[model samples]
Target: MARKWAGTAIVIYFLILVFMYWYLFNGDTSLPEKWVGTAADPATFLNARELMLSEQYSQIRNFMFFAYNAFDWIVYFFILLFGLSRVFERVAASQSKWRIVQAAVYLFLLSLLSYVVTFPLSYISYNLSKSYHISTQTFSSWMKDGLIDFWVNFGQMVIIVSVLYWLINKSPKKWWFHAWILSIPFFFFMMFIQPVVIDPLYNDFYPLKNKELETEILKLASQADIPAEHVYEVNMAEKTNALNAYVTGIGANSRIVLWDTTLNRLKEKEILVIMAHEMGHYVEKHIYIGIAGYLILTFAGLWLTARLMNSIITRYGKVLKITGIGNLSSLPLFLLVTAMLLFASSPLSNFVSRYQEARADQYAMEMLQDKDSAITMFQELTRSGLSQVNPPLLVKWFRYSHPTMLERIISVENYHTVEK
Candidate 1:
């Protein structure tokens, strides 16, 4: 019966992929405003070649995004139905007499299998970006990064999963609540260490090489009342052609980081405007707010997951080979339920993120008071990244953390008008 369902799921997955490929690529890529440029430089508005490339790139990227997520759910579902989790559990039991050691071994084995299963799709995604001339990473470099990501993520997952099961063993009824409480600190710890420890594993970060530009950015930070002592730049040119800058971490770890691509591609004024936007995030305390919001959602999601997992186990425990809520064999079901809930709640999270981003944009304009540079910066970003100015409604809802390029440009153009 599980095989029948799995076969049906595989069929449905391919069908959805076909539909997405058709729907995304065939849709109108036209913008609302025909000309985004002044009469002086219409090419800035829409270079035909660039627009075509952007559309193709966006189409493929959007397809892969949904496909990867859908397939991830399917993979977890397959593991649950096929007794793969049970196999891992037995394997772990054979290796360790201690339950905690068994749990760790089980999780490690499961994670290894999941990584192997998912690597092909990830590789394909990387190759697609490379084919589009967006990613500059070599195969060896990309593979190294992939291994690093897998291990880092697996380590974190082991910690969370172990604590979660321990809580379940202690108080099955209130474990979700307890786990959520513990996650509050864990979340912040990850954010705090992310910049200082985890980030350097992938790319080299250094204080901005241009002291003059760094001084100007420091001045902007001071004006924003940000206690930023220095600006940092990451070496990203070897990995991608994309332009990016952002504020990350909290308290002492917090720093504004510019991708080397951004520094190399953009003018000084544009860089300042970008930095101002990042500083807006810091000034408005968006990081803490975002963390708070995430924890709140996580609290609810965990509670729901616990309820849903019990209900599913009650009905399908024998078939799934899940002995109980606390059983190591139930890990796949736990993961599946959590993944489904997260996917469903993505729009809500994305909406909050977009709102925060818009506020940051507003704050940037108000601080810098330079609409032209702001507009041009986004334009250059769009051009260099070959990003679609406007994407599909579904994509925007599910995927966009910031306003679309066109929306951003229009907002900046109308900023003064709205103020008046």
Candidate 2:
């Protein structure tokens, strides 16, 4: 049995490599379509969203898109990969159903422990800013959010496990087909509703409270040709010190959010650039592109796994708390393989993203010509957040986003240099 499993594992590993090669080559990693200032309307944003979500299945999958959420996906995917590694890290093998269930249970507890490990660091992150300390959120507040995050994620895994177990036991012959059929519609639904339905559970959002700032931002949007009638301000400063601004989901949830810290620190020139960069996302129709990207990537992975590794993973899956390829108990393994593939291709993925981010920054710079302010504010960000001023080239390409401070400075300098 051991030899049999080993043979299966070896074959599966080779197929994974071959199929991943196919994916890297086949994926349209072409530079995202450029949208000089005139990509799409900030108003017509609704149309783009509606068209994507028009089909019920597409809406479900859209909720799962996570395209605009590249960073979160990066974070979660890595953590989950680490968690999955624990399965293989263990030397003991258990094949019984109860024993396998216990393994899954232990995995869940281990994940919780990882959350606890990060708890204090998360709290300190909220308090790092000395002034106004705008946030006095206690450790308890941080803990509460942590618990919510933990349970929400675990619950998702739980549901998946239950359904997968049922499918494997009852429909083993058609498990993959059934699972894929269910996943396709479910995937689209997630894309449609996650931001609108799920995000509010975490943050409180009110329409832009200060009318002057609202008008100022609105005028900036109009100048950028973003047709947003209302701007929103979130109490992000209440939660943590890290600043963020992003164009949310496609339509209803597409409002841009300003961390109050961001609002307080940067000048209008810098802020507008941030907003314009976000609008670059909107006008470029990244949301649509993202939904399509995920579905294609997921289906491709699934297709290859079914064709090559399904029997191997399923046959010995119990040894690692995995029941079968189509079982939710085996999701960690699937996730592990997917992450490995992504990790190996991290450079390419980051390269694609850096290109998009650069384009967005250019859109903002062309609109504002605020290179000076952009540099100054970024310098402040580096100082306050302890971002390394210069990082090794490989690290910047592989791990960092927003580029190194030096990268930004040089890019701006060169733009000025070339224009002169």
Candidate 3:
């Protein structure tokens, strides 16, 4: 009877999710009416449109993205339902450290298995990017990066699983709160070190070489009350032609980084406009705000995960081959529930991101008072990145971290400055 009830609950939950998906995606077919700015030439717009929204390339890419996501969920479910995770746990059960070694070994095996299962889809995605001329990474270089990424993830997973199991065994009832508190410092530490440490592992970064451009950017930064220091440029030309710039790190590690492609392709005015936008993130303290929001979400997610996992294990521990909530063998169940929770919360998280991005755009426009440059910068961004001007409403709600290109262009076109 309990199993029947659990099955019914599962069915209802998925039914609701399916309905929400349908509601979000149904009958939403809108495109931007026009482009903005003096540089928005018809030829450029047409080419960008063809690249972004054409049935041949962009549509295929979008479909592949959706299919790949579905495939990932399917794989996870297969691992869980077929007792594969249990089999891995048994293989590692005799390891030392009283479950610490077991947890590490289990996570290592799980990570390796996941990589093997997903490698085909990963390869397809890369090949598609290459075929579309969006990726400049050679196959060999891509494989090298993939290996590096796998090892990094494996190391991180080992640490995370070990800590989580420790917490679980130490205080099963309060581990969620403890984990939440512990995660705050670790999260900030990662953010602080990412620009200086992790990023360099993948790409080469250098101080922006153009003194003239750097001087102009520093002046703009000073005006915005952002710290005027060195601007960094990354060597991304070897990987792709996408134009991007951003502010990363905090305090001493904080700086603006521009893709070399942006410097090579855009005018000085456009680059400054992009720089101003990145500075807006710092000036407005969006990073700190984002971190706070993430912490809150993490707390809630952890708390809920604890409750659900406890209940599920209490009811069906033997059936699922999980000894208890504290057992490292239950990691797959924990992951499954966490994935579902995060997937459901994606819209809310994306909304916050998009809101901050819009605020940064407004701040940049007001500071620069160069609507033409802002407009043209986005036009170039859409063109160079082959970004959709207006994606489906569902995609915009869930996937987009910034306003759609059309939305941004229209906002700039309609923005009116008030006299101070």
Candidate 4:
């Protein structure tokens, strides 16, 4: 019976994958007819083309990326379903406050094991980035950041898993709903603290040193009604040659951040155009909307997970060596279900994100009123970042949060129709 149910579960999981793929691939992917001059400049177009990976390089890189993801997923599923988690639970069973200790130990082990298993792929990726002239960080600096990330993630998982199990024990049948409710505040708290507390751990941040540039950026923010008082500069050159800027945090914590490399590399006009894009995110309230969308998805995902868990536990409780949902040993099973759900929902999440990004791009073009600068800024970004002009359709659906650089350039080039 357990074998039968497991087969059913596998079938259902694959069916969901099939549906997601179908939905994502069926979308219209053609460029607009009005986007005529997007790549009309021979020099800019050739520069963008040069930034793209060679056919052979792209194949190898894409293969490595896909293989790494597949390997990671397999390792996770094997560890969880093959009873490694149960082994960890048994190791902590003799302790006082065993459940809490078990949760902590299990999570720590899980995180450590994941990192260890995935490190080879990560190392390869790092080498690939360096070979492509993307990364600037030394191996030692990379390892340091990796170590910091491990501890940070371990601590975070311990807190979250502890709360999750506590809620499960408190209301075995309705814990999913309760956990969903609790996660709303927890999610916001993480966002609120991330820029101030978490980010500074990895790199140094300072107020933007270019006073004239900062003044101009603030003026742009004012024009966008973003309520931003200052711009920040992060030491991204220490890690990567790539340039980036972003809007982060909420309310008083809200600020625009630029990579120091961006300041050094882009002209004043180009930098202001980038600032306008960041300000666009703020003015459009993408953060708040993103949070709301996440919460809704979390609610649905948790509810589905609960249903799936109950069914699985009923059929394979003894076979999987788990008693019930509230059991501390059930963490791996719970995680497996949640991870699968999240993976299956990637297209939906990416769709929303792409929409938000497109809107922000449009907003930036309107606010800057400098189509030439916007186009040049994007071209510069594409060259510096080694971004693909156009990724394959499935890649864009599954992985891309922003429109392809080609799509973005075309949209801005044909701004009048895009705004409509």
By lDDT, the best candidate is 1
| Local distance difference test values of all predictions, in order | 0.87, 0.55, 0.79, 0.77
Error of 1 at 244 (Å): 0.8
- Clashes by residue pair, model 1: none
Model 2 scores a C-alpha lDDT of 0.55
> Which ten contiguous residues of candidate 4 have the minimum total lDDT?
51-60
Q: Count the backbone clashes (under 3 Å) in each candidate.
A: 0, 17, 0, 0
Cα-based TM-score, every candidate = 0.96, 0.63, 0.89, 0.87
lDDT tens digits by residue: candidate 4, 1-420 = 545645665675566555544543444433445544556232445444453353223444555654555555556556656677677777666564656677777777777778898999899988988887778999999999999999898888888888898898888889999999989888888888889999999999999999999999999878877687888999999799788999888767876899998988889998888887777777788887888899899999999999998998898777777877887778777877887788779888999999989988888888777788878788777667665566567667777788887778878877763344
lDDT of 2 at 316: 46
- When 1 and 2 are scored with TM-score, the better candidate is 1
Indicate the residue-level lDDT of 65 in model 2.
23
Residue 282's lDDT within candidate 1 is 80
lDDT tens digits, residue span 1-420, model 3: 435644655575566556555544453444434543333332455564455343245445665555566556655555655677788888888676566678778888888888999999899989977877778999998998899898877777777788988999899899999989888888888878989988898899999999999999999888888875899999999999788898888778886899999999999999998888888887888888898899989999999999999998888776666778877678888888888788778889999999899999988888888888888888888767666666777667767889988778777878896665
Tens digits of per-residue lDDT for model 1 on 128-198? 88998899999999999988988898789878888889999999999999999999889889989999999
RMSD of model 3 against the true structure: 3.9
Backbone clashes in model 3, listed as residue pairs:
none
- Quality of model 4 by C-alpha lDDT: 0.77
Provide C-alpha RMSD values for all models, in order. 2.1, 13.4, 3.9, 4.5
